[model samples]
Target: MDLEAFRSLPEWPMILRDSWETNAGWWQAGFTEGSDVEYEEQIKPIVRVGLGGAHRILDLGGGDGQLARVLAADGASTVVLDSSAAQLQTAHHRGSSVVLATGAALPFRDGSFDGVLICLVLEHVVELDEVLAEVARVLEPGGRFLLMLNHPILQTPGSGFIDDVDLGEQYWRLGPYLREDIQMEEVDAQIFVPFVHRPLSRYLNGASARGLMLVRMEEPPPPPGFVARAEEYLQVQEYPRLLVLHFERRP
Candidate 1:
């Protein structure tokens, strides 16, 4: 069921949690981590360049400490914060300092971290504004926050890759672009995850209202092998797969 349909039912939260909790082990099998190559090559460089010399960093909602391991490998003092206990267990096993906590209520003190990395996370969070406020509160003055998410435009509800075989035209079809809603997406055949959709304005305006300044934004192009695959992958060449944003806490 979609978010709207599930909202009317009282069991949505339990269902959502069950889906993630049950799939936590399967999720760690790295089938979903195919983008790690892209992250290491494209995403991490942007983060390192943006952070400059930041030492203490928080990987908020960093499942299984994937990016935390990357940052730690790069010589940063990194901590992985996630709401999933099962996921945290995997992160802990990977030698990452894992904290079990929601983003809406970070347990750290003010100015506790010099930088924060949130990747493919906000779309699953219901309390996005509250989380942004908490990010601003915990980050040191002039600290930066790097965000990477599924592109709001390309990933909106009902949007999908379209292949016109006869015309030999392949592209993406956008759905209701402006609506904020919840969508249940199939990750694997049996797993359905909840994704909350919000407009780009919601992120920028929300961060701005919380004393965070938007420093830069990037929609990195697709890797060569991505669009070189099947016809369904061709749409990636016409649009970005992720939206990367850099925000700074004001002094």
Candidate 2:
């Protein structure tokens, strides 16, 4: 489902900004709540094999800079970049040295960053090619791109977010992994988050063509704490709540 059709009008940056500021805490909670935890435990060990503490990193669409601040605090020369002033302000307030910029048009010289992380953001942008091309241009030779996305197969248009569908094998169901070529519908929410549904393949092929070599692809399972903390159906053992991809620029 490509949601751009449901939107009679486009909310370029303003709506995007408001969506986060209004739910500013949600954005902040991601670091404490989402992949940053997995990144440290599961994703980072795989990613750090080729990179180092001295590497300069660029975090794209880095809303509120939870991971960015962590990376910066970890001795990496980290730059968190986003288009919103308020988000940038929040990131700065949260201890991120953010530059006001959009992913489609990165504000940096070629091959500037050693690695780039586009966490949970590719689903929202209309101009993915532009942003990726920009990422390719800015990443140093052999640079890495780490992307995380909400699984589109299990969650689609019009039909509300399916919490967890049963795979019917273990204690937890590993599903809602129905791959469909469904239509795009942008439902109204408290926040207007424009999303486009793409088969997971689209991301890999796109990155492959853009000079990024696919190094890793893994679906992160829910943490054991997920059941104790919040109740979501099935524990989503297989729904692919997160995808960690490590790609390096082609020399």
Per lDDT, the best of the predicted structures is 1
The top-ranked prediction according to TM-score is 1
RMSD values for the candidates in order, in angstroms, are: 2.5, 4.8
Every model's TM-score: 0.89, 0.76
TM-score of 1: 0.89
lDDT of each: 0.81, 0.66
Mark the 10 consecutive residues where model 2 has the least summed lDDT: 173-182
How many clashing residue pairs are found in candidate 1? 0
Question: Candidate 1: which stretches are off by over 4 Å?
Answer: 1-13, 31-36, 165-168
- What digit string (tens of lDDT, one per residue) describes model 2 on residues 146-243? 77776555444453433333743333322323332223233334434555556677777788888988887677675554434545435454556666
